[model samples]
Target: MLEALAQNLVYGILIGALYGLAAVGLSLVFGVTKFLNVSHGELLMLGGYASFWLFALWKVDPFISLPAAIIFLLVAGVVFYKLLFGRMVKLAEGDKIQNTLLVGFGLSLILQNLALQFWTADTRSITTAYSGAVFSFAGVRFPLVRVASLVIAFVLIVALQLFLRRTYTGKALRATVENWEAATLMGIDIQRVYLLSFVMGAALAGVAGALVAVGYSIEPAMGMSWTLKSLVVMVLGGLGSITGTFVGGIILGVTESATGFFLSLTYREVVGLVLFLLVLVFRPQGLFGVKEG
Candidate 1:
């Protein structure tokens, strides 16, 4: 029983890394631009498909094809922002949030239908020669793919942190997030920052999707579920703290894993919603979020 529990815990942490990666992108966009891009999940789905096709056609490894996925999503993000979100940049905060929500939802629906038409509603996953390989330690088994995924996720998250902290554009982004009007006064281009944040968010989502394609199954309808999970983690970790958001993802992953182990598999999905509700009612600022004045 202990071994089983340990195995579940390990699995939780592995999956949690991905949850964190997915939420980080969403958090960045919301924190920087205040535009809630609800279509983020669809972007992830597209990433997964991009990887799937690359592997299916050219026999490319999913891991090696990550750059392709990132590039694809980056271009898609640029088009999306310029066509839809760019116009809403100057709206009042309240209007920006409301309009983005509606537009994002509509975009998600359109993307979903397009995917369905192209992919035919079939579930897809990437299975490499080593996909089923695993290693055991002290009676617990660890899948090689999942472990690699965790490492990759951690590396990407750290790289993002470094980018934000060490690069000039990153500093400008932070400044804008802190105070867009003041950033503008300081000669920072607010529009450029917004565009960069949105594009980066989409790229991160693409990475998460590629990882998911290798570690799990993806379908056209999977977008909303992943989007909600990202939202939950974002709230749990709070805004403006990427590390906190990543930890929040780990917490949610472990919670779901434990619920599945002790209770029923059916309850795993419900547990996240329950936790989200509790957090909202008791501490809307999130675990790491600073309360607004």
Candidate 2:
């Protein structure tokens, strides 16, 4: 029983890393731009497809094809922001959130339909020669693909943290998140920061998608679920702290895993929602978020 529990815990941490990675993208965009891009999961879906095609056509390794996915999403982000989201950049906070939410919802529908039209509604996953390889330690099994994914996710999150803390542009982004008006007055280009944050968020989602394609499965209708997961982690981790948000993802993953193990697999999904509701009611600022004055 202990061994089985340990195995389940390992699996939970592995998937939780992905949850963190996906949520980070959404959190970053919302934190910096205050634009809740509801279409985040669709962007993630496209990323999975991008990696899938790269592998399907040229037999590219999913890990090796990660750059392609990132590039694809970055370009998509640019187009999305310039053509659609950019128009609402100057709106008041309330209007910006509302308009962007509606727009993002519409965009998600369009993307989902386009995917279904082009790719069909079938589920897809990447199965490499070594996909089944696993190592056991003290009676617990750890899948290599999932372990690699966790490493990659952690590295990316750390890289993002460093970029935000150490780079000039990243500092500008932080300043904007704190106060866009002040950032603008300080000669930071608000539009550019928004564009960069949105693009980066899309890229992160792409990475998460590619990982999912290799480790799990992808379909046209998977966007909403993933988006909700990200939202849950974002809220749990708090608003502005990347580290906190990543930890939140891990917590949700572990909770779901435990719930599935002790209760039933059917209860796994409900755990997140329950936690989300509890958090909202008791601590709207989130576990790591600062309470606004």
Candidate 3:
């Protein structure tokens, strides 16, 4: 019984890392742009498909294809910012946000249909040489791919933290998020910063998707569930808090794992709904979110 509990903890942590990675991009974009990219999940879908096809055709490993997914989504993200968000930013604040929502929702629909047309409704996954391989320690079992993904997620998160804390552009990004007008007065090109932040978010989502594709089944409609889950993590962590996002993911992972063990796998989504409600009723600002003045 103790060993099983330990295994559940390990599994939850592993899943939570990926969950955090998925949420970070959404959090960052919403923080800087004040616009929720509802199409964000489609970006994950694209990344998964990109990795899937690469592996299917060239025998490339999913990890090897991950960079390709990131690059592909990065370019798509920048283009999205330039075309849709760039124009939307020109509107009045309230109007801008509302319009962004409508446009993003439409974008998601379009992408989903496009994916269905191309990839069909068939589910897919990347099978690597190490797929299904397991590691055991102290009578506890760990999936090797999940462990690699967790380590990579941590490394990426730390790298992003350092970038935001130590780099010039990163500082500019934070400044812009705090006050775009002030940032612009200080000679920061707000549009460029926006582009960079949005692109970074997309890249993070893509990387997470690629990692997920190695371990799970992928399909055109799979993105919506992940997107919703990512949103939950972002809210749980506080809308724009990087550290908060990771912590939130960990909390969610453990909760869902415990629920699944004690109750059943079918109750997992119900647990998510419960968490959402609790957060909304008790602390809408989220665990890491700051209260609006």
Candidate 4:
């Protein structure tokens, strides 16, 4: 039992790290842009497809394709900003809460169906040199690819955190999140900031998708699950706090891992949903969110 538990914990943390990275991107988009990105999952899916195609066709390593997909999706995100998110933001004007939701949701559906049309409903994954290798540590075994994915995600998280904390753009983005009005008053190029931030967040989601494809499965419908799970982490960790998302991701991952071990695997999702609702009722501010009112 102890061995099984240890194995689960090790794997769970790795899985949670990747999940948290995806969730943090979502949080940043929602926190600063004040919009729900239903299409965010599609952004990830596209990246996954991009990476898989590169590997399956050109024999490119998944890791190498990961950044390639990011660069591609980053451009896609910028286009999405110019065509869709920007329009929604403008439509929101000052009272954007409801409008952003409706707009984003509609956009999500459109993007989802469009992907289905192009890619079909089949599931996909990429096999690599270390695809099935397992690592042993103190009588516990873990998947090597998963470990690598987690390490990559961790590095990306640290780099992003530092970027957000130390750079001029990072400070400017923080200003927008802390107070959009004041940010504009400071002559912070609101339009440019909005465009760049939205695209950057979308690009982050795309990168996550690429990393995930290396370890898991992807289908047209995968986006919805990713969106929901990331939302669970976002709500659990507190919306908009990058640090909180990391903590919340691990908690949710470990909870699911333990539940799967002690109970039916079919009920793992139910356990997660219940946890999400419990947090909603008990900790509306999330685990780390500051109370607004």
State the lDDT of candidate 4 residue by residue for 1-293, as single tens digits: 89998988886787787778778888888888887777778788888889888998999999887779889888998887787678766654455767666666776788778878987888889998889999788999878888888888878888888999999999899899878889999989877888777887777888888888888878877787788878899999997678889778888888888888888678777776888999999999899988875
**Superposition error at 188 for model 3 (Å):** 0.8
Q: Candidate 1 residues 1-293, lDDT tens each?
A: 99999999999998999999999999999999999889999999999999999999999999999999999999999999999999999999999999999999999999999999999899999999999999999999999999999999899989999999999999999999999999999999899999999999999999999999999888999899989999999999989989889999999999999999999999999999999999999989899888765
Q: Model 2, range 19-58, lDDT digits (tens) per residue?
A: 9999999999999999999999999999999999999999
User: Which candidate, 1 or 3, has the higher lDDT?
Assistant: 1
Best by lDDT: 2
lDDT score for candidate 3 against the true structure: 0.87
The order by descending lDDT is 2, 1, 3, 4
The regions of model 1 sitting more than 4 angstroms off are none
The model with the greater lDDT, 1 or 4, is 1
For 59-130, candidate 3 gives per-residue lDDT tens digits of: 999987788999999999988888788898768879988999898888889889999998899988888888
lDDT of 1 at 44: 92
TM-scores vs. true structure, each candidate: 0.98, 0.98, 0.96, 0.94
C-alpha lDDT of candidate 2 relative to the true structure? 0.95
**What is the total number of backbone clashes in candidate 1?**
0
